[model samples]
Target: MATDSAAWICAALLAFLPLSTARAAPLAPGQPAPDFALRDQHGQVQRLADQRGHWVVLYFYPKDDTPGCTREACRFRDDLHALLALGAVVLGVSLDDSDSHARFAAKHQLPFPLLADPGGNTARAYASLWSLGPIKFAKRRSFLIDPAGRLARIYRKVAPDRHSQEIIADLRALQQGHAPRP
Candidate 1:
């Protein structure tokens, strides 16, 4: 009976462990961004290699159209022109299907591509995939890839409302040949 009670306590504790703790080590700055080809909201294929010569904002979110995810997408939408002016393109990735991405993009009027990573392959490559039992999702992480295809920065924890502005500031600093803030 004592063994059974101890096992139950261990199981309870394990159940409460955050999924983020299970994620693989994320790619570090200066590492080459892992190349991938995935379908975007419009069913168009987007490849990281094709984005050479441009700054790429590769963000991974947990789900499509959720509260925080929506806020993040809308923030990017609002800042799309500013990002473009700095030679950057934003691409949001999530473990959602194409149809879900389409709706989310249309609803938010996002000009950038929201890549459908249904199988979480791209997220796994970035080490941003989070899973709890049979349920899997992407962590709220962002990677800034330089025009040279190297990772310029990685945001391990993101604040949805402020992330876009933060990226813009970083881009400006990078463009001015100054190192981004730590």
Candidate 2:
């Protein structure tokens, strides 16, 4: 009985841990970014392949309109002009439905496309989807793909509030042929 109790305690503690497992191997810089054709909040199908020749900021968040996600999306919205001026297009992805994305984008007045990945296919391809028993969602990850559709940088752990500016700085450095600091 004591051993069973200890096992139960251990399992309970594990459940409380931040244990997100990536489904695939960690992607490397200069590798081709995974291509995805997903529907956005506006119901338009957005394809990564189509965004070739322009820098792409493909960000995967866990859900829509949550505190962290909102901060991240709004920061992107607030800084959209800077990103565009740098020849970069920002696409936010989440494991939410189109309706959720629509509401979130509209509520935040986010100008960028918030792509829905309800089935987690895109998230898994980027190695960002995480599952804890029945609770599944995408980890907060971002990929900066160069104009040639190659991964320029991978952000495995991101701070929602500060990520956009981080991308902006990196974009400038990358465009200037400066090596991005890890």
Task: List the candidates' TM-scores in order.
Answer: 0.89, 0.90
Q: Which residue segments of model 1 deviate by more than 4 Å? A: 1-26
In terms of lDDT, the best-performing candidate is: 2
Strongest candidate by TM-score? 2
Candidate 1, residues 71-121, lDDT tens digits: the string is: 999999999999999999999999998899999988889888999998888
Local distance difference test, each candidate:
0.91, 0.93
Q: Model 2 over residues 56-169: C-alpha lDDT tens digits?
A: 999999989789999999999999999999999999998998999999988999999999998899999999999875578999999999999999999988999999999999
Looking at candidate 2, what is the lDDT of residue 164?
A: 97
Clashes per prediction? 0, 0
| Cα deviation of 98, candidate 2, in Å | 0.7
After TM-score superposition, the amount by which residue 13's alpha carbon in candidate 2 deviates from its true location, in angstroms, is: 10
Clashes of 1: 0
* Candidate 2 pairs with clashing backbones: none
